[model samples]
Target chain A: MQKSTQAGFWKKNQRALAPWFFMAPGIIMFLVYVIYPIFQSIGISFYEWDGLGPKTYVGLQNYRDLLDDDSFYTSLKNNVIWLVLYLLAIPAGLAVALFLNQTVAGIRLYKSLFFFPFVISQVVVGLIFTWFYAPGFGILPHVINFFTGTPTAILADDKYATYGVIAAGLWPQTAYCMILYLTGLNNISPDQVEAARMDNAKGWSMLWHIIIPQLRPATFIALVVTVIGALRSFDLISVMTVGGPFGSTRVLSYFMYEQSLSEYGTAMGYGAAIAVVLFAIMLVFISLFIVRMLSQERNA
Target chain B: MFPKPIAQSGPWTQRAYKTLLPIALVLWLLPLIGIAITSIRPGSDLASGNYFGMPSGFAGWENYSSVFKNSNIGYYILNSFRVTIPTVIGAVGLSCLTGYALAVYKFKGNLAVFFMFVAGNFVPFQILAIPVRDLTLHMGLYNTMTGLVLFHIAFQTGFCTLFMRNFMKALPFALIESARVEGVSEFRIFWHIILPLVRPAMAALAVLIFTFIWNDYFWATVMAQSVDVRPVTAGMNELKGQYKVAWELISAAAIVAALPPVAMFFLMQKHFIAGLTLGATKG
Candidate 1:
């Protein structure tokens, strides 16, 4: 009698319970670790509290201070610069991928070598570029010296420090974009390409019309990743400049790190505010990604 | 196909393309090449202004030995493994279950749960920084390897679940339906029928997560305070502080820090690319 009861209950509730049983641990961990924290961080943005001290409510004061603070503006402007300039990686990556898409000998090894930068840790990439741009022993200085009369101190100069860091970042980002494009190129419909060729679509016309239109998926992914990479660019700035040279290289992410996490002092509220702004910026892209994913899911 | 294969071009054009390939690659990897060379160059070579020239002596052994001897890099590397291995297992293992649930079950709010993981996976880490740190501290896991590993596992599950669910969804649902009709238990259906089929997806996610957790720097610094718990990426910063002017030693250490992932990338090239290009082809 108990066996029949157990079987009946199992048959009735199995589907409902089974999914939760599988999803429970993952959802619970994600909620605790990722989702709840987003709201908590947003809530903390309104108050004035150091990491250690008593939490006092100071309603929008942190955001207010952010406007008057010069370093905050510097970080904001630099973030804007990062976002605008980092888009270059996509086209740069596409160009390289196109150049190497041929059936040349030893091309596989060449492709891997080009893609090596992305595989390594960013710390190593930052260190490599830092030495590459150093004034005395850095190799890029020689190129600058050849072009101009003197080899300028690139990282220490306010005019070019962010650009230098961006260049360092592009090294890996372009490689990533290249790999994506390579795979995309591999899967492009040969019939379409041949069809376009018959219509006299050669060179630029071919790529612009036939090739690029088909590469929309790769382009979208590349753009999304590049934007996120630009905004979340903490490691490179931390390693290369540490927001040095009169705080010229501080993006929103690094700026928040300096304010709250560094040895300088913890302005927990202010840091949270900065993080909220960064989160808000990322939300635009995140929503776009979700909409795309949702549509894809519906189609599936 | 768009560019028109070089073989179809004039012989002159094809020859030029061949010549330019090596030159372009060399120039592209110039900075890495410089460091790779410097990692082995004797200190005397740098002092004598042999930056670009050939090293006077191959001090590769000496520089690498001293990096291991004079620093806690070995410890940092061990810490990295501790964090990476567990995070991979946890994230991938949990993701398999979640992915299977989402893929197989015809339950309500299935898409909602799956989409939450997708959205959360892309969020900037700065937002999560304070609260996660606080939670870790509250749970008495702060500044410990377990703290970093647990957070990595949790956070990585967001992405891994998305990947795994999509992978599982591609499998033929007919198999699951047949098994259900045969009166096999749901758990056994998952274990015997589905688990073996998702092995490729599991391997791909494992290698991808390994590289990610291993290469992580932001969380390492935020969560780990001391060298004992610090991963190599963050510890290399401290090594930079210690080896202020020792470029060769620093370069060697940097190379050492980069090896495992580079080696992994080469060894698991197929799975790594499959994992990374997960959503690039479709939506």
Candidate 2:
């Protein structure tokens, strides 16, 4: 009688239980690979070890060492520069989107062709830009030479290397932003646009007072993705300069990898410390994003 | 429509606009065009400083073939497919269930769990790299395609869950409610009723994930080390080190490596754009 009653109980609550069962593999895998690793990295940051040796509890030495580290500051500064310059993509993209938002023949093809850069791998983007910035044969150098009578190897110079890499990154990022804005523009109500036109709104005033307000959601998403992409800027730095020209191009992501994994960089603990700092910074923005998304969810 | 279509302009202005379109496109694609020409140019042209000029002879076949023959590019391409395909399938399949659960049921932690996935998806990868690599090494899966695929599936789940949950929430609840009223089980409702309805969302996510995994360079470098398992992104980097001055061959290989994601984007442009601009259109 007990067994039959238990089976009956199982049959009744099975719907609620089944979701947990279905969610098991994904959640478990995510916890192990993504969630658990976050704490593990935090723990590792407190230790002193060259990945192969016994880990010694160094208690905050890594943090203390980071205080005096010059490269860390340079990387942080370059990251700030990257963040600031990368934002230009949003406005530039919106401009392009507005330019292309018309009923011209084959405009769809034109827009897609413009967006071609974003779809290609960053490795290729890096290569293309590296080629473009190559000294004599590169187009940029020739243009500079034509103006100044001297060719410049931008990537080989410490002062300009980071900016050069950032430019390469902006090419694709701008395309991505443009596509987002184009889609956002597509859904704008034409009746509202006509209503505004009847009110004598035109050109920049129309965009600012009428159109910009409507594009708030797209702007928010653009800002979120752009910030994340800027912080995670590693592949371009790796391919274009390898954080070179005396490490002027180093960003936090590349620097972390260098310290943790490279032959000359066996300081695993120090690397983890850097990683933790980056995570903390990202967490601040992520928290804001979550709060905003939650408010949206509540409203919905 | 937002800019007021150019056709609404006077005829002279419209004629000028028509003439300017091709010119603007050429300027926009100039760098890519240069690269394409350079890729097909003979080695003699680059050596002789004839970069922008027409190639004296087209060596496209030779350069492209040499990239395949002289390097492990074939193996690298295969590795990319192996990593990308499984990741898309795993992440999408898992999210379909998680999404369905969150959308159909009113659990206590639903919003919190949903937000966690959304937040996790946007975090920097470095935060997860060290420990993920360590864990992979501990599991004896490091430097293996299986290790990379597993991590990708897990990490990608965060993004996939956000997308899937949003999509599933947009679905009508009446269908599920009616099915339940007819005495259908939740599992059967998901499998028989909800799954088919979300096929477009699944396709969108699949193509997006495929492009993302295929283009991933950082994790591929972090997890896999051996040429036997390295994907094209890392492989191309290695080839760059070896063939430093072989611009023709290097450019050919780079273009070849970039083709899959580019092709996927063009083929699924509508769904891809829809997925990317999900929240952008709505007020």
Model 2 misplaced regions, further than 4 Å: A1-3
What is the fnat value (0 to 1) for candidate 2?
Answer: 0.73
Q: Report residue A181 deviation for candidate 2 (angstroms).
A: 0.5
| Model 2 score (lDDT) | 0.89
Docking quality category of candidate 1 according to DockQ thresholds: high
Minimal lDDT window, size 10, model 2 chain B: B25-34
Q: What's the lDDT for candidate 1?
A: 0.92
Q: Give a tens-digit lDDT track for model 1, residues A1-300.
A: 999999899898887899999999999999999999999999999988888779999999999999999998899899989999999999999999999999988998899889999999999999999899988788999889999979988899999999999999999999999999999998899999998888888888888878998899999999988998999999999999999888999999999998888877488889999999999999999998889878877886
Candidate 1 positional error at B235, Å: 0.3
| Top model number, DockQ | 1
lDDT of 2 by residue, A1-300 (tens): 999999888788877687787677878887888888888889999999898889999999999998899999998899899999999999999998998888888989999999888888899999999999999678899989999998989999999999999999998999999998998898888899999999989999999988988888899899899998999999999999999999899988889989997658788899999999888888888888888888888888
Which regions of candidate 1 fall more than 4 Å away from where they truly are? none
Give per-residue lDDT, candidate 2, residue A33.
Answer: 82
- Give the range of the ten consecutive residues with the poorest summed lDDT in model 1 chain A: A259-268
The pairs that clash in candidate 2 are: none
Pairs that collide in candidate 1 are: none
